[model samples]
Target: MHGWRIPASVWKWLILLMAGGLAVLVASELHVGLGARLPDGEGSLRVTLEDQLGARPQGLGTHWLTVAALDPRSPLAAAGVRPGERLRFDRPLDRWRRFAPGERVDVTLDSGRSLRLTALPTPVGLADRTDYIGRTLIVFPALLFTLAIGWHQPAQRAYRSLSMMFLAMSAAFFYSFWFGAADGPSALGKLVQLPLNCLAWYFAADFALHYAAQHTGHLRHWLAHAMRFYRPLALASAAYTAWFALGHEAPWLWVPSTLSIGGGALILFLSLVDGWRSGRGDLRQRYRWLVLGLMCGGVPPLLTMLPWLDWETGLGRITVLAYFGGQFLTYCLLGYAVMRYRVFDFYLAVNRVVVFGVVSLLLLCTFGMLQHWVAHHVSAGHSGFGWQLLSDAAPAVLVFLVFNKLHARVEHAVHAVVFRRWAAREAQLREWLAAIVHIRSSDTLVAGLAAALDRFGDHAGSAVYLRLPDGGFALAASATGRFPPRIGPNDPLAVLLRADLAPTRHQLPQDAGVLALPMCHRAQLHGIVLLGARPNGESWRPDEITLLADTASQAGLGLQALRVDELQQAVGSLHAQVRRRSVELQAAAGRRRFGMDALP
Candidate 1:
């Protein structure tokens, strides 16, 4: 693979592009207008009704079907008409005429039996298409929010979650458009489309709780525990949606949406309550602000369902808009938390941005291809600008996404390998400098240098040898800080070397190998330090030569102090011995004088 991949910035743009396309599709569908879309009914109770009255019928209320009259011989024949049941037709009759099938009549019959009927020619009324606007407004921004959150704080456990949540919203939008334009009577299609809104609702709640937790540290534990329950809740939501769509049960849809969103809100409430009860003032303050936002963002959608709201003139659409707005606002706060708190870090954010962007772009391109194929091949020459718009955007979006991923990966790799290693070495060198704080004598200097050498063990041993005035050198300290075998004038470079002389380095061979560094003090050469191969026979780094030279200079200054102390101690000892010898001679003289006087 080429080194350059995608970066996070590009990934975000990709999501935007996709969401924009989805929004466009939704807009186009809306512009087609409700009058041109909804099946014939102006204050008429004509729902496109189909009753496939099998023993176990599925997708019964999914699409628009003409309700046929009940067959008297059918099992549900005795029952009367029921709600959502209507008369059917065999073929396209005249405008506004009562629909009729040739031979068979199918009816709901108040007992919920179904039969096939003829198609009808009916005019479509104005459908309140305001819901499309809700989808459009939410889809792109939510996608951008999700991409942003995931890219910057991917490891925070919220990243995957929020991305999936927005993706679910996108999925819902796609289904809505697909169902809106479906040509045939599709029970399966409606069955599939029916649950998308509910699922999107669940994802919305999930994304919200996670995002809130990210901001309010007090809520994190509760949110984490709440997240653990998501799998079960998701399964339940799916099950409920299936039951509602397939079983034609209203309560099934109601149960999951209420339970999932309600449960999330309850969890938030408890977290807020606990935060308030805590005596810590700062904790209470931050949490209260957060809780306020959550309520504002979360509660309205559920409350809008009440009958006092007069929901028919597109209040359902308003509810969604409230939901999206609240979620988007929370997304902004969560991003602020990430930046202010450094919740995860830059790399994770970058990684997410790149991956999400590239994937989103690819998906957008794929959708464009599918749309083109459908428009050209399946639709058979019927053309629309929507397909053209999506296709034109595909190539640019793909290129932008791919480059973003590449940039992020390359930067992360280089930082890890090169920059971090260099930083570590520099830190070690600083530590060695700190060790030389209180140096009273040369021994301390030697010991410090030995410790530093241990850090570079690939080199076998180090030795410090001071030069004598006579031009010979004596070993002062070794890697062990012990005096080694003295090198008089017999060493390999003994003839070529000088001490107190030229400020230069010279290597000399002993019974072992030769690696030498010259010690210079104030531009004066003091001695040469030799380091032998390590016991493991490993080679030292080239930088070690410079490091050794620096250490030797410090060691040279220490050696001067040692030499002075040694000379002073030797002079004092000689004086004391002379005094004792003089005293002995005096005693001998006194005894000789006494002997001579006695003889006289």
Candidate 2:
């Protein structure tokens, strides 16, 4: 039997199926691993509240805290502790020196209800400091990458969608780092984290589906089609999760988060696998790199989701390092893929992002360290507000000056490294064309054209010869050397150029030589360009020849336009003269009529 050929569209489903299987397998392993690692239920009770326990300001203070919920089976619940009921202590809860587990606590609710219960250990832990650090490292680069892609390749729908996904993830990470700290109020932290958590997974899946459909051309597949609804679904899920967290104080929001995360991962996996299987040569290689990148950056972060892994655990630190390091490597690999394949023309953008990010980060860190040292070691007395302002401004001003000086150099280096030679040639062509459009004077236009050609470095000498009204080609502009004053209409080279209306090589007497490019618009020969040997003394490449021909055509059009404008001006002047003559004749006729009438 011959090898089977899968249609490109089928890859989407295949990837999804495979990804689902892989997710299931991973989830099962994680479940087993977590079960083995998690301690038996500590003396804590899980609870959901029907309504939020509102906070009230203490006497002469703005600080707020509340018994937000109560476990249904807990000792407090047996004593009539309920949601939305404010706790009243005999002395302020804050005033209590210490309360150990099993200590009796008594409180009256706002509704005059009374309760007495034993204190119990709550299943809460301090947020790890390393978690914040790792998240910052991951998110800063991700944000920069997203911004670069969005800014540079907005037209590419896939990239835009991917950027949004990254933005969502970054926001989630930021929220976790900022609000999920141990010092933050537990109820408020959970409220802020809920929607962001949902959004992160939703956008991740959404990005995967979009990536698959766009890059793999798998939109026709049913799964890809179904993914069309994923965005709306994700939004609804996030909204619901937020509402539930705020209103009911429920932990069930994890259901939607899990579904989104699992679905997205599955789709991404399927898409990648399908792309690798179906792609040919360079495309296949690109998919391989992308897969490796995703695995490196993506897997470690996912592993951190295991309930058993806290920041204090050795495995947690390993996962954090892996996550950050993997993501950095992934971005590098993706940037390489972009450069090699010209994906969304992102090479220059990637270079700019990397340079700016690294430089800015270094500058900020150095300034921070210096400020800290100065604050502790240099400042001996209390500095006033003005002095403080100066201290802050100094570092900012220094950084700005240093960045301004280095930015141009960095940009130049980046362009030189990232852009190909042809891109430079194209840029030169555009400059020449722009000059031709903007310069209206015939002399200036011709001079700029010759200068532009010389700057291209393809020719040692160049000249523009425009057709004069006297039926001869007059030298309008010359670069680097003198040229003949005029060429007769019947000259052999001129005849050939005019007839062909194209570039042609001509040999002059005395072994002097040139390439003649006819400048023609609408079959009318406007001018000719006589180009000398290349600066390198080599024959012109085909692309260079094409460039010359195109430029010559444009020059011809510019000449034609100039001639048209001159003719219009002359015609206007002639019309003005004719009007004056007609007025004078009419005045004389009136005088003659008046004289004839008087004589009679």
Candidate 3:
């Protein structure tokens, strides 16, 4: 039923009503039906005595008893009276002789059965009180906690956890009612109890699974399987308990149910404790508190089972009230945990809390004042001007304070965690660009350039191919990879060069990579520099584009200077070799003429 497709908020109210009903039922059975039985005040008392007893005992004094309302056929009925036998009074007291309302009396029956009943002025006691407590504070808060956690998380896990907890609590309350009224440890009792144990088991196990998956050191595959085994085992135990209780001896009926419920509960507690200890940060602290709340919540039910701990006639009612208190505390803690941990980004919780808290307070106050005014004249009742002013102003103030704090916190956290990394990467890029600018030799320059481009495959491979005086292009410098083969007069780059335009960034045709800059020098078009795409396929950012342009300009100047210096050195060396050879040839000719005269 908890799994049915209803709004969580609606389910919350429903659960509250059901829990209250269960508490009331339990109180009625234990206090009025089991412990005391009083005469009906107005309608049935006179007729019931006339029909059942036939003739009343003589000189019998009238006694009054006020009994709480209860189901007719319950364990207490079986304990004191035989099936189908009616209680017979010793004397029939006249209806007008009855005690005043809100009075208690003990009545003696002819069959020696004595009954005591206390008057209920408003049919609202411990059971109703528990119901109100759970509805207003516990169930509603639990729903809020679920919404806070589920708002931005993976839906499946959140849904499972919420359903499990809701159903578990529901089943537990339902079973508590049965345990009080069931006769002779009936088979039906066992069947009813199974659902409760199974729900509780699955809820705890699923919660642990979800929590563990988010943190480090998760259960291994086999261990996870074992953990999952808890659900079915608990369910099976419930089934077995039901089957055995139907036919087995009374003492043995509750064994399986007790084991399953106790075992699952113990394991869940251990898991919560372990998780809280190992976890870190504010999230962990919040979780620890939540776990503590859960553990505390189990105490009331456990106490109810202990005979020594229970008080007299209203023990069942007191036990239920205590349980409701635990539930309230647990739900509040869970909501707090969700908000503190940023489970779904606490913004939504903050907004809802601010809005609802202000609205409800104002509305309730106004309604109370209006109700009094309706009974008496407006002049005799309290003024609602203060209520109206608060309702109008509180929401606005809450919105302003909440949003302002949220914005500041989000900004600080983002700047600290995300943007600082980006800044560091940018600094590294600048250092690389600086190195490229200073390098002189063509080979060294290419290697450095290659290293820099490797950081972003923004340029796969590039080369500085200068247009020579003969109109052919020469490879001046190159990075590691193969150069583009088509580098000639007919190429598109040559056409751009002949047109004599300033340097610009261009993309090649048909995925033909990118060119960051067309090298130019001394007001003349020098050559084309080719670049390729980065691995991530991201376009260069504006700062990166500017850096690329600067690097290209510096490289062009270095290439021009190096080329001119080498050419001048070559010419001077050639002149020296030619002059020395000519002097040698003249000396050889003079020696030959002197040899001819000596021969004559």
Candidate 4:
């Protein structure tokens, strides 16, 4: 049993490289043109078509294009081919037909109008470019996050399931983008690639259920057993979809595929409910965000998949954009949970995300309003290249001028609201922290911490527990009569504080009112701080909790320094004793040699 591990930083770079290469390949395969419209000329016509044939003339097949718009100067316009008219070809209009520019073709309209014209090239439009770019944005981050999870915590079964789900979704995005970008249906691309794309979704659904179940620790045995049959069902559905895509009509495949997706969604919802009901504190909070993220990421895409929605049309394109945006938000939240909540100990990640989001929104809104005002007043009717350049550059300049100040104000506001107490007394807290670090004895360090806590707020009592060599927590300092003399290493409160280094409220034996804060450094439990109820007997506020945690961390550092100093002193004393012993032995040997000489 052998395995290899790669650092997360390296994994990130590799994922970026892979994404860049894939982007380049997809771009190369894409057909570039002036726009979605035909060339503006006498012979050329600008025609828009209804994407669905059912919305057009009854006799027209799905391949027949229904004209939604026609340019006045076009030859087709001269021939009285108007909007609401439908055009049909001798053969089915597929990707191959759509891309072959300048080919002469026979066309018949629904009104019995017929004309011979060269097929206009289907130019890629702004909407098309936006869709492809959006998908790329979504896929890149999602892939990076997935790889990071797998590389950083490969042993975690929940993360492995999540990685697989993300991988399948990424592959599906790639295939969809690849075929969608092609000028025509490259037979190999459409047949083989399309089915594989559809197959990816089934795999994604299965993995999503597995991920949720594993994460919530619910329905473990049943879900694991069900998974054995689910794999075969997923594969069969993919094969059936593939067969159906290859000119075979089978409606039955749709039933199982739909059921699979629906079931996965149900499983996830149930898991969330179970987790929310069974979990506490951070676990509960995590489940809430997971639900939100999944909904934001998954529901929009499902809505867009409604049969009546024509995804190639303008409205459909907007829906797709929304879907991609939702997916991006979803992935961001999920990544934050997995990285910050599950694996990493950094609490500031959430704060940073919030700050960044708020600042970005403010900047965007400000920039947009300024640009609009500038364009209206300064650049109206001045459509020269220089004027256009100035219009484009003004917002950026304005943003640069004000962004730093705005960012600072926004961050300050967020901290003030989120950590009100800490923000208010940060300077004082810093001064105390500095004084605590300079203390060189355990008793002094504990006494200083207790005094600092008292100065910070009105606590009924306070005590500091220093960790003994044998792993017990002994009360080194306390406010005259605040706490007991000692708490054993195996005490419930001691064990809980040691296991989770977060500051939490705990009742001592017989319901003693105390808040226990774990003093830890780099995840090693060093000691515990017990503080009695506030003077007014109020609940602990966020800022107060935050202050306690911060103080505990500082106290841990002070205790560590004290321990190091004690060890250094012991070593010096041992060295001195060894020197004295060496001198006494030398003197004794000299006396023995003198006595022997006298006897001779």
Model 1 per-residue lDDT tens digits across residues 1-600: 001343455545654554455455545443332222322221212333443222112322222234444444332233444435534322211111222212232333233445443333333222233343444444554556555555554444334444545655554443333223222222333443445445554554554454435334465576657767864785677667666555344443445565665775676566555554552322344445556555665575565444344233334434545555675565444433332222223443453453344335434534444443443345443447765555445545654775467546645654454335434654675566555545655666765665565455443566656667766677656664333556675555544444433222334443424456666666555676666655643233334455556665655666666657756777887888888888888999999999999994
Best by TM-score: 4
lDDT per model vs. reference: 0.48, 0.56, 0.47, 0.58
Candidate 3, residue 127: how far the Cα is off, in Å: 6.1
- Cα misplacement distance, residue 364 of candidate 2 (Å): 4.1
Candidate 3: the clashing residue pairs are 64-105, 66-117, 66-118
TM-score (C-alpha, index-matched) for candidate 3: 0.38
Q: The CA-based lDDT of model 2 is what?
A: 0.56
Tens-digit lDDT string for candidate 4 (366-427) = 56546655765587668899987787697778788888788778767655654566455566
- Local distance difference test, candidate 4: 0.58
Ranking by TM-score: 4, 2, 3, 1
For residues 1-600, could you state the per-residue lDDT of candidate 2 as single tens digits? 001343323433433343343333323322322222111111232333222111111211211124567667777577666565555444232211122344465555666676665656542232333444445445555556666655555544455555555555454343332321122232243344457555655545555454545446453265576566765666767786666544333344455555665666766677767777766434566567667766676676576565344344542355555566776676656654555443334554475565556446544545554554454335435589866666567667776877666656755654566555646877987777967777667677788888777667454688888888866798888887566768788888777877777777644422224567888877978787877766554444345667878987887788778868878988999999999999999999999999999994
Per-model TM values vs. the true structure = 0.37, 0.43, 0.38, 0.56
The TM-score measured for candidate 4 stands at: 0.56
Runs in model 4 with CA error above 4 Å?
1-21, 26-118, 121-137, 171-218, 242-252, 307-322, 335-431, 437-463, 466-485, 489-527, 530-600
C-alpha positional error of residue 453 in candidate 4 after TM-score superposition, expressed in Å = 7.6
For model 3, state the Cα shift of residue 439 in Å.
40
Give the CA lDDT, 0 to 100, for residue 423 in model 2: 68
Steric overlap count per candidate: 29, 1, 3, 0
lDDT of 3 by residue, 420-514 (tens): 54456556656765665465565576555545554444345655666777665666556545566546666666666557543434424433345
